[model samples]
Target: MAPPTSSVELATLGHRIRHQRLSAGMTLDELGARVGVAGSHLSLIENGKREPRLSLLQQIAEATGTDVTDLLSPEPPNRRAALEIELDAAQSSTVFRRLGLAPVRVTKGMTDETLETVLGLNRELQRREREAIATPEEARRANTELRLAMRRRNNYLPDIEALAEKQLRAAGHTTGALTHRTVSIMAEQLGFELIYVNDLPHSARSVTDIENGRIYLPPASIPGGHGLRSMALQAMAHRLLGHQPPTDYAEFLRQRLEINYYAACCLQPEHAAVAFLQQAKKERNLAVEDFRDAFGVTHEAAAMRMTNLLTEHLGIRLHFMRVSGSGAITRVYENDDLPLPADVTGSIEGQVACRRFLGRSAFEEQNRTTEHYQYTDTPAGTFWCSAQTGTTSDGEFSVTVGVPFDDARWFRGRETAKRVTSTCPDESCCRKPDSEALARWHGRAWPSARVHMQMFSPLPSGEFPGVDDSEVYAFLDRHAEQ
Candidate 1:
């Protein structure tokens, strides 16, 4: 009421300017020189005793690497407005172009609320500490609870909105709105300060501003493309919900394994070992060494894949047998009811085992009767094959791929020895088969074989393969002469 208290307003402006100047490492005299004003006038302006002209303000802001609007912006109840202004300026600035992403805005109102809440919490904590009522353990527990609660709430609006923004940006979309209510709830759950949430706009296509952090769900009419939306949703869920234990880990592993195997199959088919299986499918012949060569995956990965294929895909109950003295079965992973050996050391590579037993008499018998079949080999020892023994399925011939061990080997030299040793009584050795040799074997095994093969063919001698550097240089030389 007394002259509208200009001093407080001037003081606030002065503080912001002073802070900006100091942050930019500029002295009062330097700032004054750049603004074309007297050092004393600049000092007075900072001390809240005088108001500088708009032009001078612009000059000062330019000198300090900021905008005139930012220098003259009225201090709002919250910092969100200030943040928005800053983001707007950044969007137009040269630096923003280099970043390649749109500048994100934080609002003054949201910042004020966040600061107030933090200050309140700090004060409460300090009071408790001063009263000798808050122990370190209590503080830790409180912090943990707070964090968990925040994480849970993060699924709601503002929090969800922020996450959606990130997701949109990642998906190569920009400029979208998220509903305020949705973002607020998500923000509340996630324990993030509201200032972070205020950056999102409300309503956008190709971008969403969700009200309650439900993820700015794409409208049903939009193409929501396969895999992309699901992936983004999963990412949003993870961010907001903090990954719910078993489900999260399982899903994460499943995705990781799928991607890993798919990439391996594409980039290095031999390493993935699928090439051998694919070859067998085409040629109707399978060899243990060929299996090993085509699927050059690690022993553990091979085992897991085999287990997955048999138990989940093929619906087969496989008894993993370990060959002991004289090819006698020492250990086995039979049905769940069958007890596992306490002292068994080695793991069977399931896929390899499946291929070995395929087309054998034992496998045929098992498929016909849906029962286990037993066969004896001097090198591999007595082996049992079963099909659909534990689970209901259409009775079909099943293969036993072996990760051959020492007892399975008929060879004597170390180089000729199989890569893996069997734990069966026979204790055969197994080795990766040579592809060329395996190809010849397949040709013989199936006389009228029509096989799909991927081979590395040698280049013909008449023409240079790919771009010939010498030819390219020669052409360039000829062009220059012309």
Candidate 2:
């Protein structure tokens, strides 16, 4: 009879059969005689190289004085067999295949000590591979450190702001909205020609060709009207800021944040943006949408820019958050002592916001056309918030800007009568279902979670964490020829 496709199960069965035969005090030849097979063929069966027929198995079991089930059990007969089985599995793994080495065949002559040594080496190899990968805990710790730094400075970076101001002045942009032409001129001032192409590397939003003094972007306009300009400016910011290739994920994150900040500063130049916001404050109409319109930027960008400038120039302590439809805090910045939901690692990015917080409640608002306002009483104090909903390819999100109740009078949404109380960080506030509902549904429901593969994956390999270097280089070569 033909053998079933070979696997660990067959190996385990062979070990059990060998063990039972020995326990019955029968030599291979003696067992084979009773089973009506050659000792060589019986040895092959005992070595997991052949499958025995059911009738043959019954005869072998009868000869060995054991049941057929005992001969087919999943467990190995002893410690030696278990080690051999584990070694076989390790050799069959992807990591073993990746080494481009021949599999080590286990033999009766191989000692247990040798098997243990080989297994130890394989385990160490796997440990090193895992160590090289960027773990979620490492990323969280890095983010926590960066967020603390941002909070210390009230989310403002004076040097980056000054650098942007110098470039904007050189581009001759001392006016209303920063035009695309001015962005182009800024690139020109840095000796970079703005070249749009459809074949830019998929991993990169824009690739700067330092050798050829060119910045390549997508031919199609980005979702937000100012995205092209922002990408171009951010690419130039890297060169202007004298950034080097990041050595680690933390450095990569810091570089990304700096470049984005530089772009925001350029988009909403300090002098003009501050003047518009001051006038809005004077009129007691400090609204994010009006700020967004005055600057021709996205709502999130306008709100984040407010975080940078409001505390430094306007004497206002505020908070900004971008929450997803599922209520996860995707982005946040604050110095208002507003108690935000965070994990033990002090990472807030993926934590769910309280259902009563404006960031989450805004999604339930009936009026989709206008901003939603609310006053939330929290452990820290009562705070007023203004949030507006926006949708992208990913899904809907809320961009919120808020302040303490004392400072709420300066904003347009303070008069809103809508209010709620949040006792979050205490899971009962939003995370935990009510007791009555839990009684009905506890242990009775199953959910298939939507897994985010990227969350489990290590940061992409290369000097730049997520950028494809080969693709980028090939793209540059293709465009450089033209």
Candidate 3:
């Protein structure tokens, strides 16, 4: 009754089976005869084309006179990420799928009763996530999927915008910031009550208590503070839009995207934003600051809106980055033809972004209060970018907006003549120029000790954001026993 192994792990097991059979000077036919399985099926299992059941594995082990543990042992990973990446690539590629293999979902004892137990446990886990009580791993996976989904959609949603705009126009707040009054008015207009609580935890942004027909928002989520207005509206959209609990990751993200779109629509009505963007695009003066000042929203909000406008409205594809103070790219979205650097997990988070990039360079300036601009040349194309640092209750982060050279004609910072060359993903050392260009500067640096500012350290696991993966995996494993 061993726990079911991952596809990659199963592959390793198959390799072990083949190795053991070879050492015994036995062909697949000989092993199949000994294990009471067809040689053709045994060959498939040996070549990692099939995942043998625990009983089959046990019988094979017995036939070979080898311990099951010997076959199940994993190779020493020099780096866990390398293996994860390989697995991800294999799972995505046609090579593995063509062999009649499927990616493993269950990670525990796979019996008939256990299968039902896993299904029940999965449903319960999903229910918890729907209520915003997801485990750390669940949250991270969902967040990753959601980010990828957003990227795939180019961070633009036309249908969602249409819905949001309709709701906004109906509420009588079609353009500009959806003030507290406007949100309240909308709630009243929709015949729903709004409740604000002082003691609500920060993480609990909003709760659409559908049963009570009231949308609850924390005092911190009040509309006036930067993105707070949209945050409040996001919660309201759930109830007003009549969205049910999402049953899967994609659905959850779509619903969330729609909710955020509804929020953004209230702040930047399509008509007004489009007119502004069209004027700026025509004038080639698309400054995010100009948009922020004109719209009275946060720089990040303005930058996010710019992507929507450019990609969906203006037909100018672009890319954006939300980088932490420590240089980790917390978020990235690109609709352009160029590829951005990403880690094996299809993530940019926790990976150091290039220092020459505006997102990272903003940190180098002593006063981060102003927007930093840069023009970068990559193999793909030239890009003009502007980034401004902003603080949150959590910590400070930089938001950047950039467009490809041809697309830059509509952007404000495009004319800034200064240029920086970036070989980024290939040439790792943007800290100085190339890895070879460092010369003696690496060891010759005699700067004063950097004062340790209070920075938000990652969770204790050093991998997940708020929840420990081991803790989550163990929790799920326990539930699997049910």
The residue ranges of model 2 lying beyond 4 angstroms of the native Cα positions read: 1-131, 220-224
| Candidate 2 residue-wise lDDT, 1-482, digit = tens | 33345688777778888888888898899999888999998888878778878899889888888888777777789999999888888888766887999988888899999999999888887666544555787678678889989999988999999999999999999888888888989999999999889888999988989999999999846555578888888899899999998766678789989999999999898888888889988899999999898889988899999999999889999999999998899999989999998888899998888888988888888887788899999999999999999888899999999999999999997899999999887888888999999999999999999998978786665677678888998998898899
TM-score of 1: 0.19
Query: What would the per-residue lDDT of candidate 3 be over residues 22-100, giving only the tens digit for each residue?
Result: 7788989999998888999987886556888888888888888887788776752223222432444445543345447
If ranked by lDDT, best first, what sequence of candidates would result? Answer: 2, 3, 1
Across residues 207-281, which tens digit of lDDT does each residue of candidate 1 receive? 112332333233333342322233233433544444432222223333333333332222122212343344443
Identify the leading candidate in terms of lDDT.
2
Instruction: Please provide the root mean square deviation of candidate 2 (C-alpha atoms, Å).
Output: 18.9
TM-score of each: 0.19, 0.72, 0.62
Give the per-residue Cα lDDT of candidate 3 at 190. 66
lDDT of each model, Cα atoms only?
A: 0.39, 0.87, 0.69
User: What are the RMSD figures for all models against the true structure?
Assistant: 27.4, 18.9, 13.3
Lowest summed-lDDT stretch of 10 residues in model 2?
A: 1-10
Better of 2 and 3 by TM-score: 2
Clashes found in each candidate (C-alpha, N, C closer than 3 A):
76, 0, 0
Question: lDDT of model 3 at residue 307?
Answer: 73
Model 3 TM-score is 0.62
In terms of lDDT, model 2 sits at: 0.87
RMSD of 3: 13.3
